[model samples]
Target: MLCGKGLVAGYLGAPVLHEVSIDVRRGEVFCLLGANGAGKSTTAKCLAGALGLRGGRVTIDDVDVTAAGAHERVRRGVSLVPEARHLFGRSTVRDNIMLGGWTKSRSHRPASFERVLEMFPQLKRLLKSRARDLSGGEQQMVAIGRALMADPRYLILDEPSLGLAPIYVDAILRQAAELARQRVGILLIEQNVGKALSIGHRAAVVETGRVVLSGTAEEVAANPLVVDSYLGGAA
Candidate 1:
């Protein structure tokens, strides 16, 4: 499990999150749903050790890894696929995927690459193609394949469905569910509540930097706030 307890953080000394806490369990998708600048990405950054905490702590299992740097956190089994796919546009897909295995020994990298390719066979044909030339969905798969190369126990994806075609969106979320079944805890940050809840076993709504609502998918789907705010209905 990856957890944050009363996390407080911000940019340039200004607090963006206030006493936020969250839980993500393996074999399940813990979806964080909210609008833009609702601190969803900030929470992901804090949990993934991409940001400094002003207060509170983050943990992997029961061990406090609050002070660890991003690379250290990756080695410890936490990986984040930030929004915008963040691929090396000019780089070949193979090179980009290879970079994700930096934590592994040279002797074991081939196996790791194979494992990721198995999950994304489409990438196999594009291994030598530049990322900038691929479609948005293909790039998204490359980003995820890269994360898998890291052998992460917990995967935090930020708005993966954004700007994707319906088919690609379903494919990405389907893979998310598949990953959870394989025992990877997924922290999916999504602005599209409907799709997020569809695969999410549990979820939370982040409003103005606080976890105002959290429960199983069924419970969250029934929450009046969720329906009113995210389901395209009147409050």
Candidate 2:
């Protein structure tokens, strides 16, 4: 399990997360649902070690990693794909994806490359293409493929489907589900509530940096508050 217990963090001395906590179990998709500015990104940063924690601790497989840095977390098989799809415009898709294997031995990269391609075959022909030239959906795939190069045990994806067409959104979500099936714990932060819940094994709704609701996906989907609020009366 990848667990963040009582996470307390903020920016510039101002708090954003008020002791928020979450757990990601291997082979399952744990969804975090919330409106903008509800601390979802902040939480992902904390889990990914991109930000510091003012309080609480993060653990993986029962080992304390609260003090570890981002690089160390990545070395420990935790990879994060932020929403921005930060690819090097001048770099080829292959180069950008290969960069993710920085922590691994050079001999391990080829195998990892093949593995990533399995999840994103569309990237094969685009290997020589510059990241700046790909469509939004393709760039997103590269970003995710880059993260996969690390062979992460826990993958944190922040708003992966944002701004994507329906086809791309479905592809990304399906890939996430496939990763979960491969026993990689997934912490998915998404805005498409209905679609997210469809693949999520467990989920939580955050509001103002706090978890307002949490349970099995079915339970959360069935909750009256979620139906009225997040599901928009569609559930």
Q: Model 2, which residues run further than 4 Å from truth?
A: none
**Cand. 2 Cα-lDDT:** 0.94
TM-score to native of every candidate shown: 0.97, 0.98
Candidate that would win on lDDT: 2
User: What is the TM-score (0 to 1) of candidate 2?
Assistant: 0.98
> What are the lDDT figures for the candidates, one per model?
0.91, 0.94
Where in model 1 is the C-alpha error above 4 Å?
none
Best by TM-score: 2
- Give the alpha carbon lDDT tens digit for every residue of 115-215 in model 2: 98989999999999999999889999999999999999999999999999999999999999999999999999999989999999999999999999999
Worst 10 residues of 1 by lDDT: 226-235
